[model samples]
Target: MGNRTIIPFGPQHPVLPEPIHLDLVLDDETVVEAIPSIGYIHRGLEKLVEKKDYLQYTYVAERICGICSFMHGMGYCMSVESIMGVEIPERAAFLRTMWAELSRLQSHFLWMGLLADAFGFESLFMHAWRVRERILDIFEQTTGGRVIFSVCDIGGVRKDANAQALDKILSVMDTLEAETKELTQVFLNDSSVKHRTCGLGMLSGQDAIALGAVGPMARASGVDLDMRKLGYAAYGKLSFEPVVETAGDCYARTAVRIREIFQSIDLIRQCVRLMPEGDVIVKVKGNPDGEYFTRLEQPRGEVIYYSKANGTKFLDRVRVRTPTFANIPALLETLKGCTLADVPVLILTIDPCISCTER
Candidate 1:
C-alpha cells in the first residue's frame, strides 16, 4: 500500500469565501477521505431569541448570512406567522415571491463569479459579479439595503415597490438577462472550465438521496426535489420546473445553477406582470404560543426554520437547519477519490455557506 498523508485545508484558504476546515487524507495526491470541521464563526444568533422580542428579532434573523439575509428573515417570520395563525395578504405574498427571485439571481451570480475565480478565469469572474451588482442595485432601490434587507417582517414585507420602481426592475431584468446569458455561455461552453469541472466529484442519485443533499447539489445528481414545489410564497401560482442534471459531477452542479439564474429572471417577470393591487402587509396581533416549522427554498438549498413560543413576546427557542449543513455529508462523499488539486472546486460546487451553516 502507498503511504498515506493527512493535509489540513481551509479555516483560512485563498479559494474559500468563508471558513471551513477539512483534514484531507491523501495517498499520492489522491484524496482517500476528508474530515470536515466547522463552527469557527458561530455567533449564537439562534440563542438570542430569548433576549429579543419576536417582532424585533427580524433584524437579527437577517444577519445570519449576508448572502441569504432576506430569506433568513422571511423564513423566521413565516415560522412565527404560522404559529400565530396569521395569513399575509395576497399582494404581500406576490411581493415576497418577487424579492425571493431577485435574491436567487444575485446569489447565483455571486456563485458563478466565485466559481470562475476558482478556475482562474479572472475576467469571467468580474463579468459575473458585474451582473450581480445590478440585482443589488435593485434591492437598494426597493428595500433600502443591498445585503441585509430588513424589509421582511412578521405579517408581510415592510417595503413596497412603486410603479416606477417596478418599471425600473423590469428594465434592469431585461438588461441583465442579455448580459448574463453571454456570461454563462463561457461557463457552459469553455473548454477549460469543462476540463476542470466535468466528470469530477461524481455523486450518484441514490448516494445524494442517502446523504440528504438539497438544492442544486441534489438536483444535479438527478434527485428531483425542490422545496419550492411545496407551494410556499406564491410558488404554486407560478409555472416552472426545477433544473436537473443527471451527471452528478461538478459541471452538472454548475449547469444547474446557471439555468436557475434564468429561471429566477422568468419568475421575477411573472411576479411583476401578475402582481395584485392591495396592501403589502397585514396587522399581526398577539404573540405566538405554539411551536412551528417553516421551510423555504433558499439559493443554496432548502432551509428549515423552527420556532417555539410560550405566549410571550420572547420566543423559547429558534433553530435553523441550513442547506450547507445538510450538504456536508454529500460534499464529503464527493471528495473521495478526487485529486488534491480539485478540492477547492469540489467544495465550491456545493456552494458552501459556512456562515449560514454555523449560525
Candidate 2:
C-alpha cells in the first residue's frame, strides 16, 4: 500500500439522496477502506415514545423512514399489541399484510430506478420510477397519504379497503406487473448494467452471516433468513418462500429484489382473495404493562422493534434496529478493493436508507 488518500464520499453527494458520510481511503483508483458515519438526520424518534402515548407512537414509528414507513409502523404496533395481549381482527390482519407487500413492491421499484441512475442509465431509471407511480397512486387512494400512511394502529389498521377496493388494487397490480416486466428485462439482460453490477461488491454467504447482514443483502448471499416467515400478521396464513441467490454480489442483490417484487404482488393477491369480512379494528383496553420485541421483513431486510410499557399511556422505552444499521458493516466490507467509480453501485445495492439509520 502506497500513500493513502482519504476521500469523503457523501453527506452531500448527488448519488445518495440521504446524508451519509463515508471516508474512503484510496490507493490510486481503488478503494482501500471505507468507513461510514451517519448522524446528520437523526431525529430521535424512539425517544418520542416517552412523550407520545403508546397508541400515538405509531405515527412516530411511521416517520422513521418514508420508504419503509408502513413496516416500521406495523412493527411498533405489533410490539405494543403483544404487550397488551390484543388480537386484531382477521380482516385487519389481511389488510396489513397486503399493504405491507405493496410497500415492499414500491420500495423495490424505487431502488431499481435509483440503481439505474447510479450506473448512468437515466432512461431505465425513468421507466422504473414510472411503474412505481402506479403503486403510489394506489397508496394515495387507499391510505390518504402517499409516503407516510397513518393507517396502522395499536389494535389494527385505521382504515379498511373494501372488496371492491381490493379488487381494484389487484387490477392495478396486474398492470404494474406488466409494466415492470419491461424494466426487469432491462435490469436483468442489459449489457451495460451487467457490466457495472455483476460480480461487483461481492460478499460470500459466510461473510454475510459473520457481518450480520440482513434482508436482500444476506439473502443475496444465500443466507436463508426472512422475518416474514416468523408468521407475524398475515404472513403465517400466506404462502411464500424467501428469495435467495448464491452469487453474493450486487447483481445477486438486484435479482433477489426483482424476484421479491413479483412475490409481493402474489402475496397481495392471496391476501385479498382470502380476506375475511369483519371489523377492521378492535378496541384495545388497558395500557401496555410488559415489554415486547417484534421483527418484520422490510424491503431492505429485517428490522427489530423493542417496546417497554409501564401500564401507562406512554411507553417506557422504544428502540428500533433498522435494517440499514445492521447492514452498514457489510457495506464497509464490500467497499474495500472496489474501484472508486463503482462505489455508488455498491451502496445502492444495499438500498441504504440513512434516515432510518439515524432515526
Candidate 3:
C-alpha cells in the first residue's frame, strides 16, 4: 500500500466539542484507516472510588461528564446497590427513572442542537436549545440543579416528585414537544440538510456489532441491542421498545435520537403514574463487601459500571465502559469512503461525547 496522508483529527479542534485524537490515514479526501487515541479527559475518577466511600462519590461521578452527569451517578449507585443487596424503595426507583428519562431528553436535545450548529444551521441550534432549556427548568425546579442534578443517593433518590411539580413538568413537556416538532420539521424536510447527512456515514449491522457499537450508533446500523432490556431501576416496569433503523448511516442515527426524545416523554409519564408512595432512601449500615457490574442506557448508549469493595469504606476497584469509547471503531469505519465535506455530519451522527469517552 502506498503511504497515505496522516491527519490527526482531535485533542483540540473546532468541530470536536471534546478531546479524542484520531489518526486518519487518507488517500486524498478518502479515509483509508483510522486509529483512535483516548485518555485526555481521564481524571482517575475510577481510582478515586478506592479512596472515597460509596455514598460520598456521587459528586465525583457528577464530574465524569457534565452533560451526562446524572447518568454517571445513577450508574455508580446501581452498581453499589447491586453489591450491597440493598432494596431501594419502589418510589425511589420510579423517581430515579423519571430523572433518567429527563436526563436523556435534555442530552438528546443538546446533541440535536450541536448537530445543527455543526451544519451552520444557527437558528435550528437556538430552537433546539430553547426547548431543551424547558426540560432543564423542570430539573432545576425538582432537583435544584440544571446540569448536575445530584439527587441520587446510594440506596435511593434524595427527593420526591411533588404533585404540583409533576403537573408543571408534564405541562412543560407537552409544550416543549409541540414546539420541538415544529422546529424539527425544518431539519427533516430540508433538502440541503438531507443531502449533507443521509448517506455520509454508513456502517452495516455486522460491522457495528463486531466493533461493539452502542447507543444510537448501533441502533442506526440496525443492531437491536439496548441495555434497557436488562431492566435496571424501573425500566422493567416501563413499556417500550428500542428505536431502530436499518439504514446504518448518518440519517438513521439522527432518526433514532429524534424518535427517542418522544420515547423519553412517554417514559417519564409512565414513571410518574407508577410512582409508589414511600420514603426515597433505605439506610445502609456498613461498607460494600463484594464486586458488582451494572448497566445503564444513557443518552449516548449502553454504559457499564463495575465496582469491587472490600468491606471497608474504600472500594477495591471501579471501572466504567462509556458509550463513545465503545463506539470508536464504528466511528472510524464511517469516516472511510466519505468525502471531506461529509466529515462533520458523520461525526455529529455518532453524537461523539469524547468527554465521556476519555473520562
lDDT of each: 0.92, 0.92, 0.85
lDDT (Cα, tens digit) per residue for candidate 2, span 1-359? 67789999879999888889999999998999998777899878888777889877898889999998999999999999999899999988999999999999999999999999999999988998899999998899889999999999989999988767888998998998888887799888989789998899999999999999999999999999999999989999999999999999998999999999999999999998999989999998878899988989999999999999998898889999999999999999999999899999999999999999999
* TM-score between model 2 and native: 0.99
TM-scores for all predictions:
0.99, 0.99, 0.96
Worst 10 residues of 1 by lDDT: 10-19
lDDT tens per residue, model 1, 132-192: 9999999999999999889999999998889899999999999999998899889989899
Error of 1 at 216 (Å): 0.3
**Candidate 1 pairs with clashing backbones:** none
Model 2 residue 21 CA deviation (Å) reads 0.4
Better of 1 and 2 by lDDT: 1
Residue-pair clashes per prediction, in order, are: 0, 1, 1
Q: Model 3 over residues 175-229: C-alpha lDDT tens digits?
A: 9879878977766778888887877788999999899999999998899988888
Runs in model 2 deviating more than 4 A are none
Model 3 regions more than 4 Å off: 1-4
**Candidate achieving higher TM-score, 1 or 3:** 1
